[model samples]
Target: MKKLLLVLAALLVAACAHAPAQSAKEAGAKTERNFSPAHVKEVIVKGKTTQKEILAKIGTPNSVKRRSLGVTTGPAEVWNYWTAPPLNDVAKGGLQPVTSLAVVFDDNGVVQDYAAADSSVLIQ
Candidate 1:
């Protein structure tokens, strides 16, 4: 009976210790950040940059997603960057100043296209 009680206690401790680290890692995966348009433009080059280059230029991604394209179009990847602080409005949520940039890459891992909105891109 004492041995059985000891085993049960060990199991309880193991379960409690196992899950919190995984949850914490998931929580840190998404980042609400202010990215600079100039910095992005300087590092990103269409038909030239690769995934490794991107990681070298920018730090960890807020998140990463995989996408599949049809056979003819070829698979593509998209990365998102925000040029302003993340906002959570209590009421009347509206855009005051925000910038978003997306970089697309073909299966070759070369930058294929990019798009940016807002005057933030005008910054040098």
Candidate 2:
């Protein structure tokens, strides 16, 4: 009886641990965001574009984070935008494909740098 109880307890703990990952996977599988790389390139410029300009041109970012640039530059803000394949594709997938853009801004709210990645190309 004690051995059986121990096994049941372990199984319960494993189920609890797995619940969050399953939830996250389901969430990702349902996410849909889309944007054009050409538009981003035309509007966002390093050392010139301000946060407000980006907002006006591209709309709101999906996420924002505050992070350290380096010891010399101190902290900076990062804005992230992304485009992902449809939920149907993601749900059927081995690896989910996405296109993403990250914009870094200085303390003065001017863009410092930006990068974009398109994983859809890899699948094609």
Highest TM-score model number? 2
Worst 10 contiguous positions by lDDT, candidate 2 = 13-22
Structural similarity to truth (TM-score) of each candidate: 0.50, 0.58
Clash statistics: count for each candidate? 0, 0
State the lDDT of candidate 1 residue by residue for 47-85, as single tens digits.
898978875566444444457444447446777654332
lDDT of 2 by residue, 1-124 (tens): 5434444554564444332233665565643334467767888778999999887676567677886446446437888876544435533545556677888998899999888776752221
Runs in model 1 lying further than 4 Å from the true structure: 1-34, 63-65, 69-75, 83-95, 119-124
Supply the TM-score for candidate 1. 0.50
Q: Which lDDT values do the candidates have, in the order given? A: 0.57, 0.66
